[model samples]
Target: MNTRLQTQTAEKGPVSVIAGPWPSYASFRSLPERERWVLYGSAKAYREALEDQGLIMAEGYDDFVRRVTRELEL
Candidate 1:
């Protein structure tokens, strides 16, 4: 990974995983504010890079999420 990416990921702190299944949005939202900001910042960085590379076209947060969802089939 890129040094900047690694730093950013680390700054976001650790993501705890529950053993059995993925957590819901509500559960995720319950995380500390700093954690949430780190997650959002990381995602924004990635989305900006994808846009720069022409891999994805997104105008803003909502658009970015929609485009990513469509691409990932989520």
Candidate 2:
């Protein structure tokens, strides 16, 4: 099975270390360093990653987007 191991970070801090099946790891790695931070994975994995970093999660969907946007900007 295809798999990828990736790390994503925001301006404020490290975001996550993600591991999962991903067919596009090669393409993803080819991206510029600045763009490599944009990783994709299951929502459950993402939520767990964020929580592992002690980030506060928003219960509402809109609020979650806003929170992520704001955090990434930091």
Candidate 3:
């Protein structure tokens, strides 16, 4: 888990920590198309986070892409 983003039951927690520094999704999303794009352009992290769920299909997708790439090159 990201230490910066972690929560314990006793503490006030991560949501308050995050909302102050960054523009929350609700605010930025209402802007014009170019305005929204410009806000997203200065990104420090991806919009979607991939979690450590221990899922198997990620390896399957890697193998599939490599196989297709090799076939296309040949």
Candidate 4:
């Protein structure tokens, strides 16, 4: 098995750390910087990839897009 997967399996339990591995970037952004790094460090590759793509969509999909649109002047 992959080392990463093995580590994850070994730690299969209540996640004490609250960080960017959050469900969404909005959640990650809501957290303090230290917490964000915690999440980034522990987040699954898929999530990190999405974040890298600059494709964050907060809970309310449409609303999040609208907000980004207005904020970015896009």
Against the hidden true structure, what lDDT does model 3 obtain? 0.36
In model 4, the runs with Cα more than 4 Å from the true position are 1-23, 44-74
lDDT of 1 at 73: 38
| Model 3 poorest ten-residue lDDT run | 47-56
Task: Give the alpha carbon lDDT tens digit for every residue of 1-74 in model 2.
Answer: 42333344575454333333212334455556455446423433677676667554425546544444443341
Pairwise lDDT winner, candidates 2 and 3: 2
Clashing residue pairs in candidate 1, if any? none
If scored against the real structure, what TM-score would every candidate get?
0.41, 0.27, 0.28, 0.26
RMSD of 2: 14.2
Cα TM-score of candidate 2? 0.27
Candidate models: Cα lDDT each: 0.45, 0.45, 0.36, 0.42
For candidate 3, write residues 27-67 as lDDT tens digits: 45556767655544433123222222211122243453454
lDDT tens per residue, model 1, 1-74: 21121112354453322122211234345567666656656666875675464332314558556544443334
Candidate 3: TM-score? 0.28
lDDT of 3 at 50: 22
Q: Write the per-residue lDDT of candidate 4 for residues 1-74, one digit (tens) a residue.
A: 21111112243542222122224444346566676555555544654465455434233435544543333333
